[model samples]
Target: MNYFFSHFHVYRSSNMILLLFLLVLHQQHYFIKPIYAYSRVEDLAINCGTESNSIVLANKRIWIGDATNSKHFSVLESSPQKNQSSISVATPHRDDPYGTSRISHYEFTYSIHGVTPGHKFIKLHFNPASYPNFHPSKSVFSVKAGPYTLLRDFNASGAAQEHRDHHHHSDPNKILLIEYQHCIKVEPGQNLTLTFIPNTTHKDSYAFVNGIEVMSLFKYHDQCNKQKKSRFRFSEVVHHEESCMNCSPSAQPPPSQTKPASISGGVLYCVIAVSVFISMSSIFLLCIWVWRNSRMKHKAKMELIYEETTNSRKSSITLASGNSCRCFSIIEISAATINFDDIFVVGVGGFGKVYKGYIDDGTKPIAIKRFIPENGVQGVQEFKNEVEMLSQLSHPHLVPLIGYCNDEDDMIIVYDFMANGTLRDHLYGTCNTPLSWKQRLKICIGAGLGLEYLHSGAKFKIIHRDVKTSNILLDEEWVAKVSDFGLSKIGPNGESKFHVSTEVKGSLGYLDPEYSKTKRLTHKSDVYSFGVVLLEVLCGRAPLLRKVEGPKRCLVEWARSCQSEGPHAIDQMVDPFIRGKIVQECLSKFVEMALNCVVHEGNQRPSMGQVVEGLELALQLQLKSED
Candidate 1:
C-alpha cells in the first residue's frame, strides 16, 4: 500500500476541476508525486586537529588527516594522540572516515546542517582498538540523533564480534569495522546533531570515533515517492455495457440508460454530495466534543491538588504521570500569597523572590518562587524546566513541586514549603543555629542521597549543575530535601549527550574548576561543588568570603590546607559553633572525604554513591563519640 501525504492546503486555481480530480483520486487510491531533487552525498572526515565545516572532535579536530573536504560534524576537543590501535583499516584519502583518531573523556556533539529538512542517514565509524587498556565491557558508549537515542550503553567490541571464540568463519585477518546507522528527521531551519557520550554507569569509561559520514536520503527513496498514477475511473461502466450486449433485455440497467452525468440528473447528484458533506461535518464536531470532555475530567483544581484544613496539614498528594497539573489563575495565587506581601517573603535569589503561602487557615503552607520581571524569557524557561524535572522526579529527598501559575506577568512554581528553610541558613545565614553533630550529619547525608538518586535512581540521570548548600532545604520534620532543578540537565544516556557540555554556569566557589576550564560538564562537576558544600558544613565558612584575604577566602582551599596538616590542625578548621561536638575520628574522615572531592581533577573525585557511603560512616563515628 502506497501512502500519499499531501500538503494540507490545496490549489485555488481551477477549484472545481481540482476538487473533481481529488475526489476521483481518493476513490481510485491514486497518488500525486512531488518533483524529486536532492544534493549530492556528502562525507565528513575527522582528523581531530582542524575545524572543517563537517568534522566533530572533543574540542578541536586535526587538520593533517581531514580527507572528506566536506562539512565536519563539530564536537569538543580532546587530547590528540597518535594512531596505535591493534587493528588497521585501509585509508584511501585525507578526508576518508579512517583518517586520524580523536578521543573524548566524557561526551561531545556534532552539528550537521547546510541541507534541507527530511530523512537523513548518519553512519558513525568507530575503532575500538584505540582503547587497549580497558576491557570490552568498559567501552560502552551512546549516541543521540535529535530526540531519538540511536544507541545506549552500546558495547562496540562485543557487538562487532571481532573477538569470536574458536569459530570457523572468524578470521584473525578480518578487522572489526563497527559502524552504526540512524535515520533522523531534521525539521526546517533546525541543524541535526549527533552526540557521542561515554556511559557513566560503567568503570574506565571514555568515548571515541575514528570517522563519521552524513548523506541526504532524498534520491534513495525518490523512485517510489515520485510515481504518478492515472486519475480516470469512468471507463469500466462503458466496457461493462459492451460485455453485457449478449445478456437478456430484462437485465438492461435503466439507470445506465438515464446516465447520472446528464443535465436532468444534476439536482439529484447535488443532494447526494450535500448529504455526504453534512455527515462528515457532524462526525468532526462529535470528535472535538469528546476530546474536550476527556480533558475536563482529567484536569484537577488547585484546591483539589492537595487538601488542607484548619486541624492538620493535608496528606501529601502524589500525582500520576498522566494527571493534568492544576493551572492556577492570577487571582487565586495572589489570594494564597496575600497579594504577594513582603511579610510572607521567605527567600530571594537570582531567579526571583520566594514567598511562603498558606491555604485553609494556615494548615498547609507552600513555598512560592515567582519569577522576576527583569529575567524575561529566561525566567519563563527556568520555570518550565523546573516543573518538567520536578514532576518527573519524585523522591522523599526531593522537594515536591505542588503546582504552578502562569498568568499576566507572573511565572511561579509552588513547592512543598520547607519550614526549616535552606541548610545554608543554619550554617551561615540568618538562622545560624548551632546544629548538633548528628543533625549536621543528617543534613549532609540527606543531600548526598538526593544527589546520588539524581545520578542513578530517577528515570534518567540528572546533573544538578548548581549543587550548593543554599539549594538544600530542611522540611518541618528536619528531613533534608534537595530543591531547585532550574539548572539541572538530564545526564548520560539521554537523547542528548551523556554529560551536558555547555557554558560553565553555577554559583561562584561552588562551580567546578575543570568544568570552567574545559566547558565539559559531568556528574563529577556536581561532586566538586558538593565538596565545597561539605567544607561549609564542617568549617562554617562561605565558599567565597570577600572579607578574608588570599586563599583563605575560598573555604575549600583553606580546609584543604588544614586537612594536609593532620588531625591536630583540622581541629582549627571545624566550625567554632560545633567544634567541640565533632568526634576526632569522625572529623578526620569527614575532612578527608571532602578534600578528596575538591581535588582539581574530575575523574579522581568519587561518585555521589561513594560520597553517601563515606558520610554514613562519618555519621556512625560521630554517634560513637557521643556514646
Candidate 2:
C-alpha cells in the first residue's frame, strides 16, 4: 500500500509539471514573445506608366516617364501604337484612364529604380490596338531587361491573334490589355533597365509600352538558383477593360528531354512557343484595350493648355512682384543665337539642346533652348509651358527668363547663362572640388526658397512637375536657381479638393508615391523631391545608382532605412567625405526634416515654407557648431 501511494504521488506530480509547462507556453503566447528568425513580407505590387499617373489605369501606380540618357516619344511623333476603336476592339470592361497615349521610339530604354531588388515578378503590359494608318505587321518589337531577352521581333497583333486561337476564340473584341509575367533574379540595388528596340525588318520601326507592373517576391538571387528550371517561367493575366478579366495558368512545360513526345523537334518547339505566346498575348490584349475608348473622346487633350497667363497684357510679362519678362523678336533672337549654331551648344535635356548665345548687340550672354519636334509631344508642350510659367513667375531662386521667340517653326527661349552649370555638377559630378558643408547648406536654402516661391509666392500656385538635383541650376555667383518649367503645371483649381489629377511627370527616385497613385498634383509632390535632394546633398550620392551596394544604392531608400533605426544609424548613411564637417545636431535635424518631407502620405509632408523654416533652424545649429 505504501509503494502504491508513492507511485501514484509521483505520477500526479509528473502530470502537474506537464500542466504547468503548458500554462507557461500559453501565457508566453499572449505575453512574452520569442524572436522569429524569418518574416513573411507582403508581396510587392508596383504599377507605373511612362507619362500618365496611376489613374491611367486602376491597376498602375508607380509611373516611369523621366529617364536619364533617354528620349521620350511624342504621342503623335510616331504613328499610334494600335487601332484604338471601340467598334473593332469593344469597350474595355473597365473605365480606362490612359486615354490613347503611349510612348514610342526607334529604341527606348526605361530604368525602373528604387525597387526591392531580388527574384521579382515583372508583368510587361502593352496596348497594341493599332491606329488605322499604322500597319499591324510593323508592330514588331523586341524587349531586353537586364540580360533577359523577353521578346524578339514580336508582332504584337500576331501574338494577339495566336492568343485568340489559344483561347478557343474568346471575346476577341473586348480584349484591350495583355500581361506577361516572368520571374528573374535581381542583384541587390540593381535598377531594372528595359530596352525596347523596334525590329529593323518591321516598317513601323517604333516600340511602345502603355503599362507595367513589378512585384517583388523573394529578396535573394538564390531564389532563382533554387528554382532554376522555373525561374524564367511566366504566367499571363488578361484584363479586357475594367470588367472582363481572365487569367491563364502557366504554360505547360516543354516536352521532356529524355523521353520526348511523338511530335518532331521542330514541331515540338513551335508548339511550345505557340502555347507560351497564346498565354502571353491573351493577357497582353487585356492591357492594350483600355486606351481605345477613352482615347477617342479625349483626342483634344494635347491642344488644351492647362495654364495661366503670367504676362497677359503686353509683350513683356509683368509678374505679381513687378518683375517683367522681356519678349524678344524673332529677328533679335536669331541675331543673338547665330541660328542655333553647334558651336554655341551648351547643354541638352529631355526635349532639346541648349546653346550659349549673345543678345543686346552680342553683349549679354544667354542660354537659348531649341526644341526638337521628334523628341515627343511633351516637347512642344514643355516649350509653351516654360515660356508661360517663366514669364509669369519671378523669384531670386528661379532662373530668370529673358525672352522668348515663337516665329513659325523657330521655337526658342533665352535665359541668363548659368556659368556654374547644374547643382548636380558641383556635387560629385563635373566639378572636382567637393562643396564645403557651409556652402552645401546655403545651396539647400536657396533651392528651398525657390520651391517655396513656386508653391506660394506667385499669384497662382504652380507645381514643378520635374524636381531633381539636375534641374537646380547654379549661376556665376554660385547662387542656386530652380530652372526647368517644362513639366510644371497649375495646381488644383477647386477649393474643395486638395490635389489636381494630372499626367504623372518626374524623375525615377524623386517621384512621390502618393502623386503616382492618385494622380493628384500638389505642392507636397515638390517637397518629396526636395527631400531627395536633401539626402543627396548630405550624402553626395545619386538618387539611384546601380554601381553602389544594395543598401546604399538608392539614396531615398537608404536614407529612409537609416532614419528608421534612429539618428545614430543615420551616421552610417551620411557621406563619409562630409562626416567630420557636419554637426551632430544639425545633421540630425536636417535628416529629420527630410524624412518628414518624404513620408508616404502627402498630408504628412510639410510645405516648402515649412521646409525653409526647418533649414533655417539647421543653419542656426550649423553656425553654433562652427563657433
Candidate 3:
C-alpha cells in the first residue's frame, strides 16, 4: 500500500507540472506584446591637439575595424534576470573619403523573448583600440554613435542564428567589441521604443546599421503636362512630411526606388508624342476621305439633274403618232393654282379636282384639269398625245388649247376658261332660270357647230369619242364649246374619214349602241351621243333616268314613242316650263334632226355637218316665230 501510494503521488505531480508549463506557453502566445524594428546611421565626434594635427584629427575618418583590430562586437539576450548569452559580431573596414568599403558593415540582433513589453530601455558601449604611435583623444568613442535599438517580443532563436552566421563569415581580427547593460520588461499591448543618432553634413565619416537594402523613396513629379518636356528635373534627395503618429492616409506616400527619377517624365513625354502623331494621322485620312466623297457626290447629283432636264426638254416636242408625253411638275401646278386656294377652283373631274390658273406671263385664266391616270404606264403618252393634237387643231367652237408645262411627276393642260360652267350644271342645277326659245336654239346650233368641226373641220377628222352634257362648257354669252379631249382620237387619215379600230370607250348613257357592240368608231357615233344631249337640253331630265325601270326608259325610246303617239305626247316630252314657248315648226324641225342623228344604223344617221345646218335653220325659224 505504501509503494502504490508513492507511485500515485509521483504520477500526480508530473501531470501538474506539465499542466502548468502548457498554461505558461499559452499565455505567452496569446498575450505577448509587439515591437516594431528600425535601423539608422549616425556620425561620431573626436578631438585632436590645438596644432594642425587637431584640424587633421577633426577631419579624421572613423570606421569599423579590420580583422587585426581589437574592437569586438556582440549582442546579449536574456530575461529580466542577470542571465545573458553572447552573440557573435562581424568584421568591419576602415572608412575612406572617396571609397565605400565592404568590410566596415556589421549587423547585430537580439530577441526580447520573455521580456515584458513597455517603454524598454537599452545601453550600448564601445571600446576604442589605440595604435602604437597614437595618443588618446579627448573625445570618448561611443557605440551609440552608430545606429542602435532595443526590441521586445521577438524570436530569440532566429536572432541568435543570424548573429552566428554574420560572425562566422567575418574575419576574426576585424570583430568590434561592444559592451552594454540594460533591461526592459513589458506586458501585453505595450510598444518598444528605439532611439538613434545620425550624421550631419559637417561629419567627415558616417556610420550605419547593417540590414536589408531597402529601396529609396521615389521622387514625384509636379510639372504641368505641357512643360514635361522642357521643365522637368531631378535632385539627389527627396523630402516629405510624415504625421506624428502615422503617415497621413490622404497623402501619397513616396514610391520605391525601383524606377529611375526620370521615369514618370519620360512616360508622359512618350504618351504625348504618340497621341499627337495619331491625331494628326487620323485628321489627314478623314479629310482626304471627305474630300473624295464630296467630289464624287457632287458629280453624280449634277449628272442626274442634267439627265432629267434633258429628258424633259426632249419630250416637249409634239409628236404626231408617238405615245411619249411631257409632264409638268407639281411646283409649276402649285404656282398655277396659287397653292390650291378656294378662289382658283374651277371644276372637279372623275380622277382629281380642277382649278383655274394662269401662266406666269399671261393674264387670262386657263382651266387646268388635274387627274391621276388609272393606267399610270400610259399616262405620259396620253398627256403628250392630247397636247400635240389640241395644239395643232384650231376651231372657233372648240375649247382652244393653251401652252403646257413639264416637270417630273405632274402633267397639266392649260385651256381657255369658260365662264358659264358646264351644260350639265346649267340644265340640272337650281339656277333653272328657264332658257328662252331663242337661247336654246342658239346653244344647240353652237354645240352642233363644235361637233361638226371635230368631225370634219380639223386638219385630221377627229372623233369626239366621249360626248355628254358635262363635256360641253359655255362662255359668258352662253356659247357652247366642246371640251375634255381625254378620249378624243384623230383620224388615221389626215383629211378623210378614217375608222381607227379601238377598244369600247364612251360615257354609259350616250355610248353608241353599234360601237359598244362592234367596238368600231365612225363620225355618226358622235351624232348618236349628240342626240342624247339635245334631248337633255329640250327636256330637263337625264337621257337615262333612274326614276324609271327597265331598258325602254331611255330618252331615245321615249322620244321615239312621242312621234307614234302624236304632237300631244311631244308637248309632254319637252320641259313643261318651255312647253308652248317653242314654235311648232321649229320644234318639229329640231326633233327631226335629233331623230335622224340617233338612227340605229350608223349609215342612216346624219353627219354632224348636216346636223349643224338643220339646227341653224331651226334656230332662225324659232327666232322668227318669237318675234
Q: Which of the numbered candidates is closest to the native, going by highest lDDT?
A: 1
Residue-wise C-alpha lDDT for candidate 3, range 483-583, written one tens digit per residue: 87778887556346356778887887899999888877888788999998888888766777555666436888888888788999888888777888888
| Model 1 regions lying over 4 Å from their true place | 1-320, 360-362, 494-498
RMSD of each candidate? 25.3, 28.9, 52.1
Model 1, 1-627: lDDT tens digits are 011112111222234555786799897654553223234354444443233334336534433233234344445332344332212233222333444344555566666657567656566666444344545557678878778777777665654552232122244444445555445666778777777778878776766666665656433322111111101000001111113454776875566544347665787888677567555555655665687787776553323322222111222234447745666777767766657755356788999899866654444567899987556445555677787788888788999878887665567888887877788777753313457778988999999999999999988889999998889999867899999998888877745664677877889999999999998899999999999989988887678866557867778878877767777778887888888778788987898899889999998999999999999999999888767
Model 1 TM-score, all chains together: 0.49
- Candidate 3 residue 20 Cα shift, in angstroms, is 86
Against the true structure, what is each candidate's TM-score? Answer: 0.49, 0.49, 0.47
lDDT, candidate 2, residue 438?
82
**Candidate 1 lDDT for residue 151:** 74
Comparison by lDDT, 1 against 3, better one? 1
- Scanning candidate 2 in windows of ten residues, the lowest lDDT window is 226-235
Error of 2 at 24 (Å): 97
Indicate the residue-level lDDT of 424 in model 2.
77
Q: Which ranges of candidate 2 are over 4 A from the true structure?
A: 1-323, 329-331, 547-549, 566-568
Better of 2 and 3 by lDDT: 2
Question: Any runs in candidate 3 off by more than 4 Å, and if so which?
Answer: 1-330, 359-362, 373-375, 492-498, 550-552
